[model samples]
Target: MKLKLNQLDILLEVAAQGSIGKAAKALNLTQPAISKTIQEMEAEIGLPILQRSSRGVTLNEYGQVLLRHARDIDRSLHQAREEIDHLLGKAMRQLRVGFTSAASYGPFTNTMIEFQARYPGVKLVAMEGRPHQILDALQNQRLDIAVLTAGTSIVQSGMYYEPLYALSNTIIAGDQHPITHTTSLKSLMNYPWLDWDEPGEHSILAQVFRRYNLPQPQNIVHCSSPWVMARMMEQADMVSMWTSVRLRFPGYNVNLRPLALREVLPATSIGVLCPNIGRLSTAGNTFLEMLRINARDWLQQSDAAEMVARV
Candidate 1:
């Protein structure tokens, strides 16, 4: 079908705003003009794209399909413009990245610093969120890459995961916690606990308790924000499961200490996720290379530290 770019733009705006009136206001047009554009698009496509109701307009199945393609086209056009501007020396290069809390505590931050040093003109936009949030942004083309912890079985079809390093989970408690020196997992049940796992899913801490045939802590608070969790753990008598690497960080180490538990928690893989290889911009490719180099150096250093500890 011969649909104009403006038609797609109207459809996207309407879907975003949830009504023709709101879309029109945002686009600086009248409600009827937006309605007519929608009607024209539907007539050209020979299908109803939206389902109208008393509340607001919602995308029908056909509209959902079309919206996906529309978003892809929109992203391509934006990327094309950016590329052309860079070629003409009218704009600086930019890269958008999303990362999880765990990734931020490790080599990812170092990689970003190294990238910035190498590409001084490249603008780096980094966002921190949960793994699912980061992955969603990457898939929607809002982000060029995502750094998060994932297992091998958690792969997505159109994404490539380049593993950086393995991270071990550890139990942490504030230094002043009553049972901070306790080695028994059962002792922790008497105090309140903090968990970062999504509701309805078994957390690594729960799994560790299960492995020992111990009952799960009853008074547990579920949270996903690392900053909140850290503050709560420091001020309250709460225990949490956190990455060992993070526990060693300067800010975290001030108040939090890894519990000396004999049980070892399973390690998870931290990696960089992106669209299929060879699809990134020049700046993105260079950043990815820096990540690889930093990750390699971090792993070797970690191994040497372990050897020294053993000796």
Candidate 2:
């Protein structure tokens, strides 16, 4: 009932290392000492916490439940220490952000620069990952905020989503690709297709084909990394769907161009995802505010440009 912080720390270490001996070594303690701690914890909780076997150990049902709370406590304690350090001027504050590659251009990058300029003392850590990976990190408390493409199916409950901009999606290929001049999806099926992995029954490209009652492309490569996808597109004749905003970014536009297809792809929105329960730190909130401002400006500019094109 009254588990101490050290007890939770030992439990976490045991769960992480998967063996008492290994946990003891990691914690700089004897094997028997680690065993005794585990026994005491089990006695206090009135249930076995771990299952031991020849292949080390694994957390049981009760241990798995406790492990989640233990990690939360660990993160809370670390944040407390960081806040104290910041107040004492002993260390710089830090913010951890996870974002999808599609969200890495234009407004997102601009907000990052502006945030850094405004909060020079806060250290910013940014990680690039697929949308699902970024959302998982945010749920696990590994990241403070996530910037990803907003999809109703992809955003889980218990997270707050703020719509940023509805970016235009387009099929793109290397400028030299033979099919680059093709105007219809049906005509491009003979060429290899590169698809970004999305969390759904079908990818956007596949959905588009299905909507038109066309057969799905036979030669398709599912890719997760944007950099790898870009490199592959540049080196091969493969075509892929990407956001217009991302395609406009420097390295991409240099070698890749949107195919002039008559098909109008559905626009995808980029958004900010954060904990809805006010878990964000002051620094995190400031960065979120800057993102909102930049997104507003970017949306306004996009509207004006669309109007000009129509004129």
**Regions of candidate 2 where Cα sits further than 4 Å from its true position:** 1-92, 180-182, 198-202, 302-311
Best by lDDT: 2
Clashing pairs in 2: none
Cα error, residue 129 of model 2, in Å, equals 0.8
**What is the lDDT for 28 in model 1?**
98
Q: What local lDDT does model 2 show for residue 205?
A: 71
The most accurate candidate by TM-score is: 2
User: On residues 138-226, what C-alpha lDDT tens digit does candidate 1 reach at each position?
Assistant: 88899988888764333653588887776777788888887745477787788899987754433656767887899888998988876
Candidate 1: pairs in clash: none
Q: Count residue pairs with overlapping backbones in model 1.
A: 0
Residue-by-residue lDDT tens digits, candidate 2, 44-119: 9999999989999999999999999999999999999987757745323888888877787767889889988987
Residue 170 displacement in candidate 1 (angstroms) = 1.2
Alpha-carbon lDDT, every model: 0.78, 0.80
